[model samples]
Every structure is written in C-alpha cells, then in structure tokens.
Target: ASSRDGYSWTEKQGLKSGVPCIGTIQPPTNLDRASTEVFDVIVVGAGYCGLTAARDLTTSGILVADNPGSRLGLRTLLIEARDRIGGRSWSSDIDGYSFELGGTWIFWGQANVWREILRYQMQDELVSSYDFSKGLNKYILVNTERAQHFTHEEEDEMMESGLRKLVNVDGEYGKRVIPFPHTAAFTAEALRYDKMSVADRLSEIKDSLTPNELSGVEAFVLLCSGGTLETTSFFEFLHWWALSDYSYQGCIDYLVKYKFRGGQSSFAIRFFREALASGNLSYAFNSPVAEIDDTKDFVTVSTRDGKQYRAKRVISAIPLQVMNNVVFNPPLPSGKRTAASIGHVNQCVKVHAEVRNKDLRSYTGIARPENGLFYAFGDGTTPAGNTHIVAFGGQNGHFDPEDNIGTTARKLQGLVPMDIERLVFHNWSKDEFAKGAWFFSQPGLLSNHLGDMRARHGKVIFGSSDWALGWRSFIDGAIEEGTRAALTARTDLAPSQLKGKL
Candidate 1:
C-alpha cells in the first residue's frame, strides 16, 4: 500500500480473519480516485516572499470550511525546492555560536522591513555595531609601493566631492557626472552616477586625491561593488550614496544601528514557525518542480516524480538567473524571458574566518597589488570571543572552492596578525537553487530592464529582494517586495467582495 511518508505497509491478519489472510483484497490503486482536488492559489516557493504571500492571502477575511460549497475560500500551497524553508537566509550553530550564512544586517531607516520586525515583536535582541560617530580608520594597499592610510576626514571630503559632481553636472561644476533613473526627482538624483564606471570617475578626480586617499577610495569601491572599479558602474555607487544620504558616515551609521543580535537568521526562523502554525499551508520539500504549464482556467505544476498539482493562480518567486532550468509550456512571455536572460548580475564568493584572538580591533583592510586579499573586516561581538572576520573576493562567477580558501587566507594575512582557527565560506554561484547572492544592475541594463524585470505577468507574479526599488540587495527590499506582491495578488483576486455577506 502507498503511504504519505513512502513506507511499505501490510494489513494485520486478525482484521481480515473472515477471509483468508493471503487472499485479502488490495486497497484501491488510484490515489486520485476520491475526487479532483483543487486549490485557489499555489505559491511556488517557501522563501520570505512566498511565505508572506501565503500568510497574508489566507488570513485576509476569507475562511475555509469542510463544506465543498462554502465559497472555497482561497486554499494555498507553499512548495520549496530545498529540504527546508528560509531560502537564502539561514542560521546555524557553529562551534556553539550562531552564525548566519546568508542575508544578515538590517538598518534602521529601511522602513518596510523594520515595520515587519516590530510587528512580529522581535526588537529586543537588536544590536548596534562599533561606534561610528568617531570616524573609523581605512587602510588600502595598491601594489607594493602604494600602501597607505586615509584619515576619516580625507575619505569624507573625497566622497562628498564625488556626490557634488554627480548631482550638479550642469551647474558651475559643469554637466552631471552620471545618468541616473528619472522616475522622480529622488530617482533622478540617485541615477546621476549611472553612466560612468567607478574607475573612470575616480580618474577624473585623481589629481585631488592624496596617494593614501586614492588607495582608500579604490578599496572602498571594490568592497562595496564586490568587483574592481573598472567593472562596477559609477551610477550604482551614486545610487548607494543617495540611499544613505551621500555620506559614508551615514551609510556606516545606518548599518551599525540596525543589526540583529542573534543574527539575521533569527527573523527567518520566526517567520517559518509562524507560517507553519497557521495550519492552512502545506509544503513539499526536496521536490524540485520540473515543468509548469498554465492554461486559461488552471495552472498545472508537475514535479520530478510525475505528480501534478492544479491551481487557479501561481507565483514564481525564484530568481531570474535560474529560470531557464525550469521548463514552462508555451514559454514565459518574451519580455520576461529576455529580462531574465539579460538581467542577471555576477555571483559572489564570500569567506568568513574565526580567529583565536578577540583583542584585534575591528577594522576594514583593502589589498593592493603586492597584497593577496582585497578586503577584510573585523566582525565585532560574535557570541564566542573568537574574532570573526569576513572577506570578499572574486566577482565574475563561481570560483574553485579549494583554491579560494587558500587565496582568501593569504589575503587575510596582510590585514591582521592572527592564527586562523577555522573558516567558513559560501560560493553563491555554485548553489543550484540560487545562482547568485543578489541581483545587481550592469552598466546600461538598469535603464532598460529594471522596470520590466519587476513587472508582474498575467497570473504569475514575481517578487524578490533583487527586484526591490529601494535597497535592491537588502533584507528591507525582500520584505517590501513580499508585501507588495501579496497586495497585488489580493487585489487581483478580489476575494473580499465574493464573501457573500460574510
């Protein structure tokens, strides 16, 4: 007999005593013989976006009862490709201390995500980073002969000048330096740095930078963009500045004030537990979807095992980079397919190391040509006294894991003098489920594809932090898109009006 947990079964002899035990009739072979089950909505992921959509859609006034004729208030199914929920946001114990593998750190002014944290009553554990008021020292090594340091004042001046050039291009300073998005005055201001590469823009102001200051800015750009200056768009830097009010001080302050004490993974745990308790959602783990076919009346989603699920509406919360892997009948719309094809940014390779000493002050170091590593930062106050330092290396695509660990360690040696006790790193590029850490806009692609990439298709909605209009690569954006997508779905269905007088 078939079982839900996939276990072999046999009937007890005593129950069929009247008939010969060997001749006991087998149970019905067809599992679907009872009735054709149908659901109102089928959310295709269990990430933050999928979970939020499922929760909001179910709790919104519509009710489900045993009676088949009872308006059939929105039945929802949440499926995850992984064996567990929480997608990219994960927290696990490492040496008895909580370590976050993906998506950590949230700032105070994030607005939407902050609201969700408060709504869930998870504010008590919030922690702040090292003091930002007293400017932090920045170090940079550009080849063997160019190692230098920048005072906080010099760094601030350089960044401020860059911002001024970006905003007042046609003013007394000349034409604007970048071509930012023009949706609103704010967006226009944000996009001013879009046209130029960071390296090219820096070259324009190289005369004003002291040797040490130039290296410092170069290092900062690399760390922020996860790539070298030549490849990172100048406009993206300006957009980041605009989001944080054009000041590194403001940006660092924002990051420090909105960190999670236990780590960002705590929020994921809470969300998943609450969703599971709702009793309205069902999940199929380790079940990768092979194909999706949508018709005028219903969408049929098939799994690898040939099992099929039918629903009236579907949401594709997966990232666009991996869209080609899943087959879609008649294919997704040309615009969406094109957006998915051309819109993916490069992947990231990040390394986290635990050192034996905590006395090492928190610092950020940039590597030069002679130096092996480009960036390293002391992660302050981890649960264990072991100093936690994070490094970002390699930007184009997946790197050799064995080669990466050694290369990363050599780079760290240039920054701090500590014995490396253990190391942990994740190459987001290698993960099949997530092809990259987060989506980033290439040079000219932002202007052309940003809008269409985020737009919802007929019955298949799209939502991910990568598509967020505000802080595109942040947790704040994830929550924002999740809520916005749910609202769009609810409004489309108009379930409240069909409740028949409640």
Candidate 2:
C-alpha cells in the first residue's frame, strides 16, 4: 500500500485489494498514556499558532533529568483535527505538481514569518528559487473585458494617502489607532473606524476618485478584505495599513509578492520537526476537538471520539467560527461568545489550475463581483508546457472548487484567455476545520469584542491570526499569536508564577 512518497496514492493495486487508496482518516488511537492521560500543557489546532506555541512551551524548561539548569520542562501535547499541519497554509499536490491550496505567499514585511524562514535558512535567491513577484505583468478586468488596462499609479497614490488619513488620529499615523499593533486593542480612533464598514467609508471619498480609479481601488480592496466593503470593517484595513507603515505598496508586497520556494508546507514540516524535537510534545492527527471543559482547576479536552486529555494550560488555536461549535463548560467570555457567533467576513476562494498552453502571460484579470471572474494570474510554467495559474474569488458559494472549477476557468479564459486542462481547489469556507478564509472583521468587532476575546479565561488562552495585532488573518499573524500564547501558557504553568499570571 505504500507509494513512492507519503503524498502519492496508488489506485490500481489498492483496488485489487478491495481497500481504498485514499479517504478520510479515522480517530487516532494507541497514544502513550504519558501523552493522553495528562500533561502540563495541551494546545489544540496544531496549525501555525499551535505548533509555535507547543514548541516554545515544551522547550522553554529543562527536564529534571537533564541537569536541571532552568526550571522543569512543561510536558505538552499538540493535537489537530485535520490530517495534516499548516491549518490554513496548506501546501498540497495536484498531478505531481506542488500547489498551495491555501495561504500561499509571504514576504519580508511579515516579520514573524520572515524570522522563521531565517531560522530555518529556507531563503535562497541566487538561483531564482523564491518566486518573488518582481517582474509579473499587472492586468485588470475593465468593463467586463480582460482589457489589461488602467494603471495603478493613480490608484496607488489615492490608496496610500487615503489609508494614512484613515488611521491617522492626533495628527500622527498609528499613534491613536494602532500604537502596539501586535496586541491590538480598541483605541478611540480605532473604535471610530471600527464602527464604519469599508463601503461606508468609501461613500465619504467617492467624489475624490475618478470612475476608473474608483473601480480599480474597489476591486483591489475587495480582494484584500475577501468580501464586500459593507461586510468588512474599516478597522481591519486600517490595521493592515499601519502594519505596512501606511504605504499601499508595502501592503501589496506582503500580500502577494513573495512565496516559499518549496511551498508553505515545507515550512510547516520544518516547524513540526523543531516542535517534536523540543521534547514531550505529542500530536494526534485526524482528531477533532469537540469540547473543552474548564469547569475544574485542570482543563479536560474532549475529542469527537469522546476521548479526554487533561492539561494545566490549554491554547485554542482553531478558527473563530469553528471555535463557537466547541462547548465550553463555564462558557467563554461574552466578547468571545459574541464574536464567535458573528465569525469573520472573509470567504475568499483561492484556486490553482494548469493549462496545456505555452508562455501564458502573468497578469491579474479583475472584474466586479458577478459580471466576470474576480482575478486570475499565472504562477509559473510546468515542465509539460502547462502553465500553473492561481485565481481568487471574493463571494461565497459562487465558484465551488469541486463543482464550478470548469466554469471558473472558462470565465477567466474569456478575459485572460487560456487552454483549459485541469483544476484543483479546496473550498476553505465550506471546510469543517475552517469555516471561512482569513480574518476581516465585521462592523463593531474591533471595538466591541477583540479585546475581551483576546483575554485569557481561567487556564485557557485563545490565539488566532483572526485577531492578531499585526498581520491579521495571515500566517505571520498566526505565528505572532502562537508564539505569544505559548509564552503565556508557560508563564501560567510555571510553578514560580502559577497563581494565574499570563
């Protein structure tokens, strides 16, 4: 049943054996009692944040048998509901080609992720290994046509200035709105913007932009936020603007300009290796955490299979929307409860496709929501003369990856034009593990829920890129939150500081 590598599947032989070659996995079993019975810390969701938290939590202290230089090491267990790591940042395969079905790109602007890359020595630019968006042609859908016209100079100028004006309070950028962005809390200026949606703010600036400029900015921002401006809060974009130092160009650099040469999964694999090597970190795959009972002094985590694991400290790194489904014994704070009910607004669909064509120009085909395809661009050419392309959809249930990939290709072909071959995508919004894509808050979330939702409750600490102070909804933010949560858990579990500190 074993294939050439862990990823490939063999169908012919498995079919003869009357067993499936590929399918959904069953609940994990055979975990050592040391891992399942109890531990110092148990972190859920094994994604970027969970992995990072577990790594630091387990590695921070020295084992009693190992000279005991530092304090006693915290025994930790990290579990995931999915079969693989990298929660939203999954690097997968399609027809033997490396493809990123989710959270694809990263750049230097993302400090935390960049630090990980540097720590692992994964960056090598001498051979053109990293596909930095240095020379790709920019294209936009104009008037329902893949016209590839309309320059971003005017739009860029407008956006940079507008973003600065939006976040600037007390005549200074980020002074009032996002002073300490990594742990974003409500500020007077932040609350003012949090009350307004992107669409609402657009109304105030509509007269300042030309018609083409307006549409260009609108589509671009829509792609950025993953929903209509009406559903996305201005606070989200304002925070991003501040993260990018109030420059439109810096924001774009982190959003799409850079990518890992081997794929984001490579980073995840490397991260897991470090975490596992840190010691006493056990992980369970194909395990969905259903309930977290913090009723007693110790936290008991229950999986869908009814198995329970106890820990002194717990970090819930799952998606906000999915987190609502998990029953909490004492119940979550009103802020987390209210925010979980509302969830995030982002439902963007990202798809990767290959076409039997040559020299397909790399360009972004932009269109309004329903009139045409949202955006399309070529990733690179495969050895078989097929061009690897990636596309994004802002609306929900409109372009299902399984049922409507063909239609999506045709729509995009009409604008950018390409010979269709094959397509692959995972509907993240429909995915059980992650109910939606990245984080874009609805109106009032920043002012009403973010601060309280971020606070720790009893022995449980919540961490997600959804509310990260910087790089919200991104892998960078995930790392920031995970690293912070791990540190918080360590402090709370440490004997010297155990009186509910953190």
Candidate 3:
C-alpha cells in the first residue's frame, strides 16, 4: 500500500508506513536502518498505563490550562512490542468461558480505576465472583508441612491477627511508621522498616504464630511478593494495607473476588480504539525498544531492529524489570540502577485450568509447598462440563512455561488435588517485555529508590504500575500512573535537578 514508492518492501513483510509489524523480528535479516519518526511526545508500551497516558495526553484542554509553557497542539505516538495493546491485562477464553490470565479485579475502593469506570459508565460491565478463601477445601502448609482442612472462620481469625502483627511493627498500626501511605511523608518511618524484609517480621512475630500459622503467613507473603518473600520490603504490605483503608479483608477482596463482565482486554481495546479515533496517535507492534537516548533538546527511542523514533519527550510506560534490558545512552542514575538491579520481585505465572466438571465450586486461596503454583481457584464453568480455574505461581525459572497443559495440570493437582482436564496460561516472568509480574517492592526500594524511579529522566518520564502511589500492582495503578505521567510530562514539574545522568 505504498503509493509514493509504488511497490511495497517485497524484500520483507507488511511494510506499511507508520504501521508497525505485528510479528517477531529476527536480527541481521531485514531492517538495516532505524526509522526516526518525530512527535511531540512518544508513549512507550501499549498496556493499561500506556493506553491511559495516551488518552489523557490527547484530551484537549486537560493539561493546557494547568501547564503554563506546555504545548497545547501536541502530536504523539504510542509504541508497543507486541501485536496486542493490553500488556499484562490479557483475557483469554477456554471452551467459551472467560479467564483472566493477568490483572483480573477492580472495585470502588480503588479510586483511580473507579473514576475511569464511572467516567465511561462501565459500572454495568462489572461482575462479581466467589471468594477464594471461602472455598470448600483447604490445603495449608505448617513449617512447609501440608495440613488438614480448616474452616474459613478459623483461618480468617488467625490470618487477621498475624496480619495485624505484621503491620503493627511498633504496635501502633504504623502510626510512627507509614502514617501517610500516599506520599513521601512517611519516608523516615518507612525507611526504618524498609531495612527489614518480610522474613524479618515473620521471625519477630514467630512466637505468636503456630507452625501451621507461620507457614500459612509465609505462603501469603510469597503470594503477595509473587515469589520469595525473604528479600521483599515489609513496608510494601503496609502500603497495601493503607491503600486498602487499613483492612486486611479489603486487601483480599480487591485482589480477587470482583471482575469485569466482559474481558478487561476488551475494555482495553475500547480504550485503545477510542484513542486511535481521537488523537494523532500512530503505533507499531513487533517493535521492541532496545535503546533510549535523551539529548539536551530531543529524545530518540530505538527498537531492537535499529528503528528509531524521535520526540520532544518520551514516556516509558513499560515494566520496571524490563528497564534493565533497554540500554540508556547516559546510563541510568545509580539509585535507579540499584533498584533496577534488584528489580521487581513478583515474577508470578497466572494460569487458567479447566476440569471435567459441569458444576465445580468456585473458590481460591489454596497453597501447597510441593506444588509449584502459589494459588489456585475456580473461575467459571461451561455447559460442556468444563470448569475453568485460575492459578498463580510467583517463582520463575523453576519450570517450562511453554508446556501446554499436562505439566501445569499436574502442578495444580499437587496443590488443589483437582483433576484438570485442560490448562492454559501466559507466563509473565518469561515475557521479554515484562520480565516479572506486577511490582512487589524489594527491601529499601520504597524508601531509597521509589522517588528516583518516578522522577523524570531528562526528556523521559516514567509511567507504570511498578512505581504507582496506591494500587501498585493493579490495573488501577497502571492507568493512574500512565495518566499522571502524560499530564505531567507536558508541564514543568520542577523535577529535581538530576544530580548525575546515566
């Protein structure tokens, strides 16, 4: 479809101008030169955060009145590595049943995501599901030993008490620590706890907990951290508790239980479609950014294949872990490099398993040490006697993520003792663009590097759930972070004078 040149790039495939190829790119084969497209601002990553940032920045008069010297008539482009736009928020189907392999829940308590739902009148699209903790059977580990079934009421009390002790480090409900969860107000107090890992707290409160209780609590930490909890900061949980309005039950409720009527990916599509229809936005897939260079005036983003895009400013809405993959021309700041070196902890793999049952009880919160997966729960059932369940495993590089069904089914069986008929999943840990699951801050990150991570890097602004204020790991966090990054990128944010550039 090249009218100017007449013939297409027959040397390769899908050589449409401005339309990125929605496939893989092999090295030293096709593209030899980097394409430099100019824009006022170029948003990277097409996930929820990237999409939301693009949408808000495109809205006329939204940031114009607030930003004094900012350009009102701005041209922007969104770049994504994959063909799809949803990023981690993927909604797949098995035997015609809905299964969310990524970020799956949203509620009114998350004011950021709630506002979007209200703005788009998507309340009608909301659907509720059964709680995983209230499941019929229970399989918990006590000192890594599997235990018998316990009633929900009994488990709740033990967990609530244990959780209270975990956050009430000073027995003051974080009054002397993390008093303000929204900003750097509690930086000093937060740092005191930041030096301690989740395991450190578990050891301190070990006396109050039984062996079984301790194991359950440790597993919970693993699930929350997305893998090992030994090195994760204790303050991350406190931040989550504060975000959940100081209620442990609320934290559990928001993480699971609620869902979208249609798939969230569909919602993302609607958002992306609207963005395409409204803004001067153009995008390309199969284009993985490999390098970012910000000079005194303009910024250039380069893909792995040597394609480059130039812009006045760039918003990196990609995952925090993936930052290490991209070569920063001026090497990132030491603080960012330190945090990035440690990286996000949650490399959990979320899988959807189907069992041969017409009616299976939909529940979650099942963990067994032998089983590689950290959690499992029933999602939905099909008329064809297929019961869909979603499962998660935080530890990465432990097994083959490419194995289709049998391997994962066997792993889930060890945890829930279910007879899985078929299994389907997407391993976020294995994803090249997203090296890990949602952000689970490591010890000292919240105190030492979160501010540095969010601080604009010259012409680049960071926008991701990885460093969000409230819902750090949820879709709400991604959207809010993306929107804020875009809106702020247009303004003179009085960004701290970066002492040294990487």
Quick one: best lDDT, which candidate? Answer: 2
lDDT of each: 0.59, 0.69, 0.68
Model 2 lowest lDDT segment of ten: 15-24
TM-score of 2: 0.85
TM accuracy, model 3 = 0.84
True-structure lDDT of candidate 1: 0.59
TM, every model: 0.80, 0.85, 0.84
Ranking the candidates on TM-score from highest down gives: 2, 3, 1
Stretches of candidate 1 above 4 Å error?
1-36, 62-73, 131-195, 255-257, 369-372, 382-384, 396-398, 401-404, 495-502
Off by over 4 Å in 2: 1-30, 33-36, 62-72, 125-138, 145-186, 369-372, 496-502
Model 2, 1-502: lDDT tens digits are 1111122112222111111112112333326755446777888987788878877787677322333335545778787887677788766544445666678778876799889889888877212212324344445555545364533454356556655544454577665676766555567777888888878878887776665556666766777777777888887777776776666677767676677656677777777777667666677877799999998878999999877999888899998878888998888878889888888888887766676654453455566545434656667666566777777776633555455444666666655666766565667777888877888888888778877768888889999888787787899989999988988876665554433332
Best by TM-score: 2
Location of the lowest summed lDDT over 10 successive residues in candidate 3: 1-10
Candidate 3 wrong stretches, greater than 4 Å: 1-37, 62-73, 131-147, 383-385, 492-502
Q: At residue 105, give the lDDT of candidate 2.
A: 78
> Against the hidden true structure, what lDDT does model 3 obtain?
0.68
